[model samples]
Target: MTFDRKDKDNVTLLNFYLQLLYPRMVEEKMLILLRQGRIGKWFSGIGQEAIAVGSTMAMKSEEYILPMHRNLGVFTSRNVPLTRLMAQWQGKLSGFTKGRDRSFHFGTQEHKIIGMISHLGPQMALADGIALGDLIASKEKATLVFTGEGATSEGDFHEAINVAAVWNLPVIFLIENNGYGLSTPVNEQYKCKNLVDRAIGYGIEGLQVDGNNILAVYDLIDSVATRMRENPRPVLIECLTFRMRGHEEASGTKYVPHELLEEWAKKDPILNFEQYLLEQDILTPDAVAEIKANLKMEIEQEVEAAFNEPEPLAKEEEELKDMYFPYTSDPVSPEGPVKELRYLDAISDGLRIAMQKHTNLVLMGQDIAEYGGAFKITEGFVQEFGKARVRNTPICESAIVGAGLGLSINGFKAVVEMQFADFVSCGFNQIVNNLAKTHYRWGEKADVVVRMPTGAGTGAGPFHSQSNEAWFTKTPGLKVVYPAFPADAKGLLLAAIEDPNPVMYFEHKYLYRSLTGPVPEGFYTMEIGKANVLRQGQQLCIITYGLGVHWALDYLDENPDISATLVDLRSLQPWDKETVSAAVKNTGRALILHEDTLSCGFGAELAAWISEHCFKYLDAPVMRCASSDTAIPMNKALEDGFLAKSRLKHTLNQLLAY
Candidate 1:
């Protein structure tokens, strides 16, 4: 419904009350359920209901809102079915996340709500991405993201706001400053006088309002949203409110002062709004009582119905479903002549081809636009696709990664480039928790590719040079691809972009310019999870990927008499188990090699799998050749010693002899 300041008819007033009171009643009932051990937990938005209700009511239905756990009014204001919402809270199959998540933790696309992650700050960046999508589509839409004052202290908050301000995206950073983060007081949270003051640092419009006053919040947000749709820029709004209840019912308010509680109680948002309505002759005492009574009854019935609903059943096959969108590869055979390209050029060519093929594809990274990225992979991307598609982002890895996820949510294929593979550690949370789990938790496809320029050998030092693919290989729902040659680099990159799942494409820095091979002129894709056998033999099987593939090739080239099978496991996560097992069984010896540390490396998984599946055919124990458990040193001599190529050749010889 349209919010009008001058036209506050009885019907409008009553609807607003319903919007405000419904959540109040629902929260009260939820608390009761929590006390009765009916539901798992409740994050009560006891006194600060107006911020959610007012903000949600002010926005257009087409616009999006990312609400925190405490903003239950946003859900009620959007008119989400109470039965289904309660079912969600009860961990039933009818819930939005299919019982994969609880509370307001899951987002409903139909309601235009993007769910907030437990890591509260990342949603801010996600909001930036959604806004970016809207802006790109030329849709006059704005996105509102809610965060507490405590969450603003996170690096994601700064990164998201900075990115939003720089891009001038239509995003409203709503800070529900409810006095405390769990038990910590606001005085200790930040040194600034007001949360709104920090907005000036980002050069964005900042405002503060009496959050407990429903009318004031509604009027301000309504006006702000109207302006944002037209102007399309970031704004930071700090809602001054209080949390009357504990962080959760179980976390008691013993740490909160009795005096403070009394003070906030006097400023209860619902009571104050009711008083305002009464003075305006809009809602009488009886009317208020009647509205609350009806809402309470409605909430009770819905909660009861939800409680009676069947809980999510655990089936082995069902549990494994929806981790990723079904992907089928249609192999493209080159009809024309192929040309030789460097690994870096091949990746660049693949990116260009994908961008040309998919109009909705976007590339984001630090210095990717004008500076051509740290490694110059995207040197001419900005010129080719313009800044909108090939956007340069701040050095905030976490936020940009989250923004990529947000873009994917809005039907955009996003490819985020980490300047170096080691730098992925900064964006680790977004990759592993948000991107990796988005599909499994809520059946949302995270069609994003994170390009990681990896490996050591250039004396790039510990941080820049790392074979950290194992970190994500172990994480469920993430596809890790490490291509050894230039052709595989291009083909796998295109394949990764096309996959409807988050794919980590690892590019070895040493192979970028040093490796050259024939790549098809036109677009082509290599199958992920499938291994390519470079050589065929019968005495021994060598399973490896990335730099190890080259090492094994060189070793085999020198020792031609030693009959061996060299298998290039192009994909680590869904490694070519079929090919590796067959090769191992045929050869009767298995040797795994990698650039990562020997202990707990991806090779270890291969070794264990080979031992388990190929045990009967094994002529000797499965051997592994990898780096020692130490950081890659900057000194060339030290790095060479760390890689231990001599050890790799010796290990292969030992396995073949056995």
Candidate 2:
């Protein structure tokens, strides 16, 4: 029979093709629910199913994966119930993670489908981390980080792969090279002849496989997996496949010339595989028909099941609400080994201690290994812990972030560095979509920290300086912290490292060396969300955080007559409204201050909240003193003017005016 003999093994090519085709068709069918009037938009991995399915099949159930958005074929082939997949596509309750998971970003730890991060290339670091974990846990499992050729252009690709290669992490960095990253073709995007060739840059093995050959794909992955079990090194395999449809449902191939589409269409993987099977006499014509029929029915049934299942309970939406809420602390002091040092010293010490205890704790970033980080924050880390733990990364922000994500998912506690806070935009997806949303997706854990040098006091100008806390403050399931003093800095940072979610630890560059404080020797735990009253007053509640908290402290000290209650809301995500309300009620006047621009800043959210709940007790309208709505200035005079320089005397005069 032509259908049955397609493989040397029991599997048939016809059956494999159906495994690819039917599930995709069904997933697209579900998308029609929200897309009014049958708008046919899909990132169809149609031409690349053989590779997706074969690689998926070859992977052990225990092995994990970091899939990108277009790998729907692989997801369906893995037996993910169609209904849940549909729920995801439709943004309904029935979707993965109760619809908290974005469309095409589905994950299940049970299924070893670790995640599908929304951003283009951030998953690389997460996969590296998970691989680290697997090694630490001594689990006989490997991780796969799947991306596109376009994604490799992201800094994350280089960072993640380099670290994985250097650390000998058991991860396979697979690039689903579908020729184009959106409208831009691979040829136009880079000078590299092939993505597979990039592995040499990381000093790892690289290969190119025929993505249309399911058996070849399976064999290649199986070989890689086996090699990983022993070598524990990262490798890259570029599957030279073509995407049948546009990048996403929203995109049409209008941008792609018709000739190119038609030419590529002639080489559809399913058709090619089918012809190969027919030539080999692997599957008979009659048998192929039966398999297709069965696959179609199975896909339809899964869709029906997904549609019939009750949507994730809308009334119980509160269950998914903890994305930003901080956990309460234990009454007893968290007992970890304590150390006495300066605040930055404590941060450095914590890293030293943690890495000393856990060999798997890897610290990577720009100039972190030898040059002691751009901040010199990681000074002597490499000398103390060696290159494995303190790694100097390339100048690729996306690559470094993606590598950190991979390391974390691989079971390494990665402290990723972005040379400056202004550069965080380069690694934004790693912080937001992937690392932040990972825990909710796997329903497991991804404990990692992303540290950046933030704020602007030096003459670094507009480009080199920024405090983008407000940018990340709006993202759920992420904790953003800025410390006013050294003790809080060390304690809170340690807390973030142990936390199961991703954290953005912003350390102000101005205060790093200037605002030194004696941190007690040994380990001490600081509760994350609980706001502390630095100075108690009855006249007005000066609600502030981060660099502003330090300014407020100095202001309050100078103007004791104002009788201001200074509250530092340490953790911005699970922000302390209760603390703010109590302070406002006690003082009857509230002022919100921050270093960010005035327009839609974090303070704006706090002010609106006060207007809703604490407005009745306001003795004065909430006053805000923040940077004017403009980019930070390059000139010293304009720069000073643009910033919200504190004047307690000026603010008090206003309250008196009211």
What value does the lDDT take at residue 473 in candidate 1?
Answer: 94
The whole-model lDDT of each prediction reads 0.89, 0.73
> Each model's TM-score, in the order given?
0.98, 0.84
- Specify the highest-lDDT model's number: 1
Candidate 1 C-alpha lDDT tens digits along 1-658:
1233466777887677778888888887877778788777888999999899999999998889999999988988898999999888778899888888888778888898988888889989999889999999889988999999999999999999999999999999999999999999999999999999999999999999988877788888888889999999999999999888989888989999999999999898877767777777888888777877887788788878888988778886866667777778776765577999999999999999999999999999989999998889999889889999999888899989999999998889999999999999999999999999888777888999999999998998899999999999999889999999998999999999989899999999999999999988888888999999999998888899999999989988888898989999999978888999899889999888899999999988999988888899999999999998998899998999899475887897787667
Residue 544 lDDT in candidate 2:
83
- Top model by TM-score, which number? 1
213-251 per-residue lDDT for model 2 (tens digits): 776787889889987887688889999877767777578
As a whole number from 0 to 100, the lDDT of residue 325 in candidate 1 is 70
Model 1 error, position 283 (Å): 2.0
Q: Over all chains combined, what TM-score does candidate 2 have?
A: 0.84
